[model samples]
Target: MSKKNSESDSANGVRLDKWLWAARFYKTRGLAKDAIEGGKVDYNGAKGKPSRMVELGALIGLRQGYDDKVVEVLGLNDQRRPATEAQALYQETPESIAARERKAADRKANNGALVSEHRPSKKERRQIHRFKSDVFSGESL
Candidate 1:
């Protein structure tokens, strides 16, 4: 127990990728590294690197799916833990939470506009193809 504590406590700050994975932000360190390299992550308002050390209380901005999240590091853990425990490692800022909620609401409101009644039947598919061909044919123009 003491040895484990010593090892876990030894890290003053974990690598950006490692911390992201450990905190459940990304499923794997490689994915986290990719995100950092792809300009999807920012540390303390600057671009982040995979090898960068993640210090506590530092703000991290990362894009996850459709939501751009900003979290403040509260603790550092090198090893990945369960989702609940991982959540404890950082706190999403109130502004980030509000933004995410607003985006979600907007998406929900617009979702109905994108829904179709049903998939086109085979006959309808053929008709669509014919219509497209006729529209593009020079003879019609």
Candidate 2:
């Protein structure tokens, strides 16, 4: 028979990055580390390193490429889980749900993308060249 223990009594608490990876939220530990370092992950409204420990009931925020996920820490483990099973580790808040919806609306109205200061991609450079070629050529307007 398996015995159940309280959350605090069990050795379930772990580093934030570990929990994220185990929960299948991120593919690798490095990805989790980068996210934490870039301030894309927060615990209890405070930015912290990837090695930060997470306790039960702590509020966690995850900002991925185009979405922000908020969850309450329910449990922690050292093993990764399937996409579906991993999702059950945390409970999503209503506020985060609303925030994500609003962000989606804003993004659609603003060119269907979130404008970033990052450098242009190679495709963008090619488009720029093509546009300039046609506009700067000796063609009639």
Candidate 3:
């Protein structure tokens, strides 16, 4: 193998935060570091520090908003790269992908129930104002 290929596949590994940022898991290295320190990122099923070395094939479990992702390290790069290149750095487990998609669908469905299609009518607004005034004036609605 070429030196470049060997270096990229080195067993020494890269810093967890740097790899995470380069892999596009976080927008910035600082954010990746914070996530690692906050226990939102796990390496091989154990919580890892920002400076921890993440080797190829290592399992990483990370929480992104409400979704939890488990991916295997496929490649490493110190510098941030394009989205497509970054995506090649890690391979998400099928189960994790399915769970994330299912959760997103559930969230979308639940959100529809809580959203209003339009603003309240003028009469409804007037009633709301009257109720607020009555409460503040110590009068029953």
Candidate 4:
């Protein structure tokens, strides 16, 4: 291990999920584990097991929905840090940065998601209310 790495791992190797969470890669350990299990995370550009040990210099790939990001492991942290400090634990290479940007652009171009900006039309709203009323009515045929 590099001298810098030795200093960080002094606390014992952090769990993969915990590392991701502490590094601000994922919001929670559950999400981190899910990413690992889903094959969305790769170590050294190869598939990695969720239990894989991480040290400095290891390349990590992450896929969260429409985004695919990669960062080089810099330090280990057992506890979650503030958002500002959390991002300090790793370094992202230019290649990964470009890839992620392209992936995001592609996702935006191909996926017609109106998730946040959409509102149901009046007819669509009426259909939902009618369905609920029919399901709850006392009389049955």
Candidate 5:
């Protein structure tokens, strides 16, 4: 490939929010921007702006819901791609991967203990509603 074609193929860098959206970390660029502005994303261990340029080898810390992920940028792309391709953009650190798995397992175990086989019956629902009303109204029963 010619030098010009290579340069076109790999641009200088991509915006942080754009990279997050392209990597499938967020459903849309707006969501990614919100997260960045909300302090849910850190670049190189410090808070970053949505418009910050993301280049190869940069460390990114992303908090999505209850999980935190620390990944090193491996590639840069502004356009959203398939899951497999998106995954290639960054590599999660081993410690982050292990921590996430442990947290997931703990959550699963805690939730499993409270799992019910069936939904509540009409009587149960009514009782729950009545109890909530009593509590809110400062009633004894």
Candidate 6:
């Protein structure tokens, strides 16, 4: 009824940082605000501010760990909600999903090829020298 509409559509939207936190993009409003201030978030393809008002169907680009996500705002909420409800507030774009999956697959494929460039420690160098000397000494088994 009228009461419900008033509660849900009071402002028709909420602050970007609050929405980000409510949508579970960030665990807390502080984190969301920090991300916005740090240039880690975009609103409608432009840099976002913590107080920016979020509108439906707006594209938001944010970085989460090693993945960059582009999500379309589906709904607006200011209060943090459960994970399931939060997820319903936005939808990741298909291209973003595909990119994240491809990156994951590429990471998995290259996991075993890691190369270390650090010089051996003194202890490790000593061990290697001992092994080389033993091999050169030709000690019988």
Output the number of the lDDT-best candidate. 5
What digit string (tens of lDDT, one per residue) describes model 2 on residues 1-141? 133443443375678888889888889999988989999999999996787787889999988879898989877765676767777778889999999999998888897456667887999989989998988884765
Q: Going through the candidates in order, what is the number of backbone clashes in each?
A: 0, 0, 0, 0, 0, 0
TM-score of every candidate = 0.76, 0.68, 0.73, 0.65, 0.73, 0.75
lDDT of 6 by residue, 12-93 (tens): 7788998999998888899999999999999999999998889999999999888999999998888777999999999999
Best by TM-score: 1
lDDT, model 4: 0.80
Worst 10 residues of 1 by lDDT: 1-10
The residue-by-residue lDDT of candidate 4 on 1-141, one tens digit each, is 566875566366766787898887788889889889889998888887777777778888888777777788887776787988878889998998898888778788767674546677899899989988898784664
Better of 1 and 5 by TM-score: 1
Answer with 1 or 5, whichever has the higher lDDT.
Answer: 5
Flag regions of model 6 displaced more than 4 Å.
1-10, 115-141
Task: Kindly give the stretch of ten consecutive residues in candidate 2 with the minimal lDDT sum.
Answer: 1-10
Candidate 1's error at 16, in angstroms?
0.3
Name the regions of candidate 5 deviating beyond 4 angstroms: 1-10, 115-141
The CA lDDT of each predicted structure is 0.91, 0.82, 0.90, 0.80, 0.91, 0.89
Residue pairs with backbone atoms closer than 3 Å in model 5 (clashes): none
Q: Is candidate 5 or candidate 6 better by lDDT?
A: 5
> Which residue pairs of candidate 1 clash?
none
- List candidate 4 segments past 4 Å from native: 1-11, 109-141
lDDT of 5: 0.91
